[model samples]
Target: MSSTTRAARPVPACPIRPGEPCTLCQVDVTGPQDCGLVWLVMGDDELRAGVHRSRLAAPGRR
Candidate 1:
């Protein structure tokens, strides 16, 4: 058998969804860095807080 090496692709993390990687779900953006939904959610103080709270309340989450 022959062995070949391939470069590892870096997985970008989701900014709003803690401990989760970006899934590239947005059609207009490449990743979480350029995601409009992430920007909008993060831009609002209340929304950001709500996301944080939800993350904390998730089952099996630390």
Candidate 2:
């Protein structure tokens, strides 16, 4: 019998938070929609879903 181990998938961090500071805020913006983090999260379905779920879970969201 042979045993095999599967590698774990990488999970992206959430991009935005209702109250916490964002990565874009720490740097200067060259354009209106120039945030790299936003671009990354928006482009990825998993990351975008994570961000959406977080927003819904935030306090006073209901």
Worst 10 residues of 1 by lDDT: 53-62
Tens digit of lDDT per residue, candidate 1, span 2-60?
A: 99999999999787887788998788789988999999999999999988997898676
TM per prediction: 0.70, 0.54
Task: Please identify model 1 stretches exceeding 4 Å from their true place.
Answer: 1-4, 59-62
Q: Give lDDT for model 1.
A: 0.87
Which candidate achieves the best TM-score against the true structure? 1
* 1-62: candidate 2 lDDT, tens digit per residue: 99999998543332566445443453675422666767877799998898789888988763
* Residue 31 displacement (Å), model 1: 0.9
